[model samples]
Target: MQENKTSFSQRLTLLKQKEVKQTLVGILHGVERESLRINPDGGLAQTPHQAALGSALTHDFITTDFSESLLEFITPPEVSIDKTIGQLTDVHKFVLENIGEERLWSMSMPCFIESDDNIPIANYGSSNVGRMKSLYRVGLKNRYGSMMQAISGVHFNFSLPEAFWQEWLAKLGQEANKDTISAAYFALIRNYRRYCWIIPYLYGASPALCGSFIKGKLTSFEFSKIGKGTYYLPYATSLRMSDLGYTNSAQSGLNICYNQVDTYIDSLRKAISQPSVDYQRFNGKKDGQYQQLNGNVLQIENELYSPIRPKQPTRSLEKPTDALDDRGVNYIEVRALDVNPFSQIGIEANQFYFLDVFLLYCVTKPSEFFDSHLYQETETNLSEVVNRGREPNLHLTHKGESISLVDWALSLFSDLAEVAAELDEANNTNQYSAAVEVEKQKVLDPSLTPSARILKILLENNEDNGSFGLNLADTYKKQLLATDYQFMTADDLTAHAGRSVQKQLLVEQQDMQTFDEFLRSYFESSTELEQV
Candidate 1:
């Protein structure tokens, strides 16, 4: 740990000398929250995408995640954290105005789901691409169950300025190219695996869940009874990130290498191409209706669920890997964050700043080559934190050795303090440092963590998962409706929605192939990753 401290300190000193503080970091933030409408009897809302939010297929900022009820709000990359948050808040405001009696679920986990058929799959318009999108989700529902598809979280898309990387490359005497930049980002991912468990330990809010979620699934742990049909681990942080969450047992054995782009792509390619005996039963159609996209382990690359991923925006009909192969990683998406139930918006600005620092720490710190054993170790540590993170003197593995969670978190924060200072110096604000201090307090006092706080509230209220989340949902809905849009005007938002609807109409009209032909071409097509 001392060696880790010294190495980061030296790197920070060099970074300061390069005077890269003014480099503007861009954030492409998006929040995906699944909610149920407040009907006479509380149940999952069976509603279509609201007309006010625009077409789910063509909207840039508003779309459905998996279910029609699951609203995902996206914000374009913005340097100003305030504007970024403001935009997201406005999206929520717009949505609330139109949802009528509906309320967004404050937590990451879903409410009391009756059955898989109760949840409606998201419907895109009548286009080949749109049909493909819906078919892929049908595949997900067939393979994993609709209940797991209802699980939602916020994705933090982060990218540093190219100038910052160019300066670092020059300082390190390395060539500046897509391959070099990508290698550096991969190194960052390696380090992220080493310490990202701290994220759920601090921000994980889904410690409990509705019993219906686990009704048909495996149940081996002891759970304290809340209200009717609700159970939670006494010290659990995020049951949503646990094995019971979005995990697929088939993909668990995949030892994907993140040390380079090619290795990562190769592993994903093989998984999607390889056939799985478990999924083969669902490969054929039922009554001449396609049950799934194909018999492969993964319907597509996007089916591969991970805590983090290297991302590049795809072109029309282009695959995720196609975009990545065409250009190196444009940004890294941090998918571990559970939507903060406390805030009206899914995330706070300070939370964004904290993540920015943490990601920067991952890239700047020295990273060793990661392997299968270490990757599984990362999963083990994360499971421990998610299931029993608040347990006194909890232990986690670091580089194959046991260390107290608090000790490791504190040591990591020490390095982050320096990072915050440097970023503040560059940005001419103390917000980054202030955010670091706030997170530091979470590590120092476990009670201050969001997971702990949520558990405490539940215990005090004697409320179950459904009742507690419903209460928060009502509160947030009222708050959002009361507030006006801060970033964009109401008319501007409506105009964007209208235009997106028009765009979807145009795409439907321009379709050249049948859904069947399009699906076949997509699978049989030989798409190659662009080499540098």
Candidate 2:
């Protein structure tokens, strides 16, 4: 177990590398309306009312479970393993047919880096806290390719029970580590996923909830109608952060390939099919493009669109048609993950296969990477990707070298083929090879990626979509909808203000409070929950 200290940043980084944790990669998949889709001609399709409501895809389902649970529960039963290939496609098809289902789901895979082969590790949750944001932005990191955390720097989840937390951690967990975190810990998900972009590791759980829910004791029962777990658990993972920088660089000449996978999406969108009668396609025609998505793999890519909004020019704008450049990626949102809607496994097997290749590609390249250089080349390439990631013979860069996306993907597919074969040897007689090959073909043919098909959908729907930025009005609306969550919502803020004015009414009644009295009365009360 890792010990805690008072220094905030120092302790946070250290905690990420703890040993008694069961940490694994978390793949989040969310869904809602495509209010922000643009037409093939590059025009918006969002209406005024919808834009005001917000355009980013909203989530209707959310779940997180241990990695072990995933292979145990979500995997096909012993008798069904042989048919997993075609049947798995049916799962993808089910999802595609319900694009605007207004739900969010997630699964966890029990995975550790090949490097962590012999190490018994811990999962420390993470976060930048109040000052975390500026550090990442002003400085550069992630050069090792593995150094940078995927999505949020502090990435993790938990598997706690609602009743258990109500009886313990929420009341005394943080108090036990008061000298370190200087706060109480609740076992729930709040102000995260949607707000407070930063997540911290407390017990190697998906950002083990860190704050005492003093008033609300959900001891009897608690659950999201769509989520799998009754409550969250403590995060418990550790990290290996180092200071050496500049390991390698993309070279002038290398045999790299760059193939966009856009075309694949188009083909799938035009030909989906599902065995479930409720979602089966109409007449098996391409006209119902969604049918194509049936059983098609779900590769989610959530991204922040800057809209070319630059901060006020430091020295004033030069003034020209170049005033606004296209927005670059703030962070890529990878969705398409299926929530063990029925359970809380981090992610599915097929999902992990794609994620491995994708993340590995993002972090490791022949050439060295820096925050600055990546922004310069990647932003340009991203446009082409969003525009045509699935196009056959697409181009890409590796180790500072260029290659065709088709050939590059083909090469990767070959590697995956070997991996599938290897996995088959270890498990069910290599029966899963065909199942894995399915997506490889999807990538090669350039007709299975979503961004590729969305082009036509936006065009057919007359794509003149719009979006909103951290809007006050919109945020307030979300507050209204989620009556329970808060880090001080606008309404709570006012209540807090009023409460402060009347602080004298508190039990202390003393101008200066005493530490001993405060500790006993508040934290060490005889409540069954607060037993430190």
Tell me the lDDT of candidate 1: 0.80
Stretches off by above 4 angstroms in model 2 are: 1-349, 356-383, 391-393, 429-432, 457-532
TM-score of 1: 0.95
Per-candidate clash tally? 1, 100
lDDT of 2 by residue, 1-532 (tens): 1222233233222222322011112212211111111222212212111111111111111111111011111112112222332333332222222222221112111111122112111111121110112122111111112212211111211121223223322222332322212111110111011111101111111211111210133232121111211122111111111011111222112211111111212322222211323323221335422121122111110011121111111111111111111211111223222122111122234543443333222211112212334433543343333323444566766435677756655675564455444334433354446655655655554334322232233335433111111121133223324443222233433343345334313322432534334323432331111000
TM-score of each: 0.95, 0.27
Top model number, lDDT: 1
Candidate 2: worst-modelled 10 consecutive residues by lDDT: 195-204
